[model samples]
Every structure is written in structure tokens, then in C-alpha cells.
Target: MIDLALNFAFVAVGLAQVLALVRLVRGPHVGDRILALDTMVINAIGLIVLVGVKWGTQMYFESAMIFAMLGFVSTVALARFVLRGDIIE
Candidate 1:
């Protein structure tokens, strides 16, 4: 059923978010932590979309889009900082 599938997706994404958080905290390298943070952002977006589907609302979709854009920018900035020792030159 569609409802069952949605529930399963939610559970899977939730677990993924938790694991990503663990990796973010325990990762040995800065790059690994950054990757984990990116993964967490993706999982958060998945959760937002799932909530929008369940509630039949359009607002969550907009929120998800905004979050995605911000996540991307932040990730790029972090990567740049790690590589160049500064985000802005």
C-alpha cells in the first residue's frame, strides 16, 4: 500500500539521518564530516518532502527547496574553506 511505503521511507530516512549525525561527530577527517553533513541535509530534505506528501500541503515543498539551496551553498563554502583555508578571497 502507498501508506505502508511512505512509512517505510520515513523510517529509512530517519535511520540514515541518525547514522549521518554519528559520522559527522566521529569522522576522523574534515572531508568525512563535511560529507556526513551533506548527507544529513539530503535526508532532511527527504523528510520534508515526505511530510508534504502526507499532509497534502505545498508549503513544505517550498521549504525543502530553500533548504536545499542553502545546504548546497554552505557545503561549497565549507569545501572551499577546507581547501583554500578561506571561504572568501
Candidate 2:
């Protein structure tokens, strides 16, 4: 039962990721695309955490944290670019 639940969760996350990717590609505006990309990264982190739990390893969680940090930085940079035409200063 636990295994089945994990499998289902994985499938759901995978489908969500595919939808997010589609949105990122088909978004009408740069901001919308960036938001979609952020969502994708978040979902990826969740997937990694789930997998880590299933495998009894902590490395996936650490990587997930790194991915989240990078995603946040990228999102801030992109938003700054869109708002001010430059990411640095």
C-alpha cells in the first residue's frame, strides 16, 4: 500500500511537471513563463524529497534545498530584469 501510494504520487508529480513545462513554453508573457518555470522547480524539489524518503537517503533532500535556493535566486534575478532591464545594480 505504501509502495502504491508512492508510485501514484510520483505519477501525479510527473504529470504536473509536464503541464508546467507546457505552460512555460506556451506562456504569453515572460513573467508568466518565469512563474511556470519556478513552479516546475518547486515540483521537482517535492519529487526529490519523496524519492529520498522512499530510498532512505538524505542526499536528495540536500540537493532539493540547493535547487530551491537557486530557483529563488533565479526568479528574483529574472523579475529584476523585467522590472529594471538589468539584474546587476
Candidate 3:
């Protein structure tokens, strides 16, 4: 059933977020931490989409899109900062 599938997806995404948090905290390098942050962002988006599907709502999907865009920009900025030491040159 769709309800069962949705519940499973929610649990899976939550677990993924937790794992990503652990990586963020225990990462051996700054780059790894940045990657973990990106992974968390992705998991967050997944959770958002899942919520949208579970509720059959339109707003959550739009918010998820916005979050995805922001996540992409932030990830790029973080990676740039790691490589160049400054987000803006």
C-alpha cells in the first residue's frame, strides 16, 4: 500500500539524515564535513518531497524546490570556500 511505502520512505530518509549528521560530526577532514552537510541537505529534500506526497499537497513541493536550489548554492559556496578560502573574491 502507498501508506506503507510512504512510512518506509520517511523512516529511511530519517535514518539517512542521522547517518549524515554523524559523518558531519566525526569527519576527519573539513572537506568530508562539507560533503556530509551536502548529503544532509539532500536527505532533507527527500524528506520534504516525501511529506508532500504523503499529504497530497502542492506547497511542500514548491518549498522543496526552493530548498533544493538553496542547498545547491550553499554547497557550491562551501566547496568554493574550502578550495579558495573565500566564498566571494
Number of the top TM-score candidate: 1
Off by over 4 Å in 1: none
| Candidate 2: tens digits of C-alpha lDDT, residues 1-89 | 98999999999999999999999999989989999999999999989988997998987877999999999999999999999999997
Colliding residue pairs in candidate 1? none
* lDDT string, candidate 3, 1-89, tens digits: 99999999999999999999999999999989999999998899999999889888888988888888999999999899889999989
TM for candidate 3 is 0.94
TM-score of each: 0.96, 0.95, 0.94
Candidate 3 segments whose C-alpha is farther than 4 A from its true place:
none
lDDT of model 1 at residue 12? 98
Q: Write the per-residue lDDT of candidate 1 for residues 1-89, one digit (tens) a residue.
A: 98999999999999999999999999999999999999999999999999988888898978999999999999999999999999889
Error of 1 at 43 (Å): 0.6
Pairs that collide, model 3: none
Q: What's the residue-level lDDT of 17 in candidate 3? A: 97
Candidate number achieving the greatest lDDT relative to the actual structure: 1
RMSD of each: 0.7, 0.8, 0.9
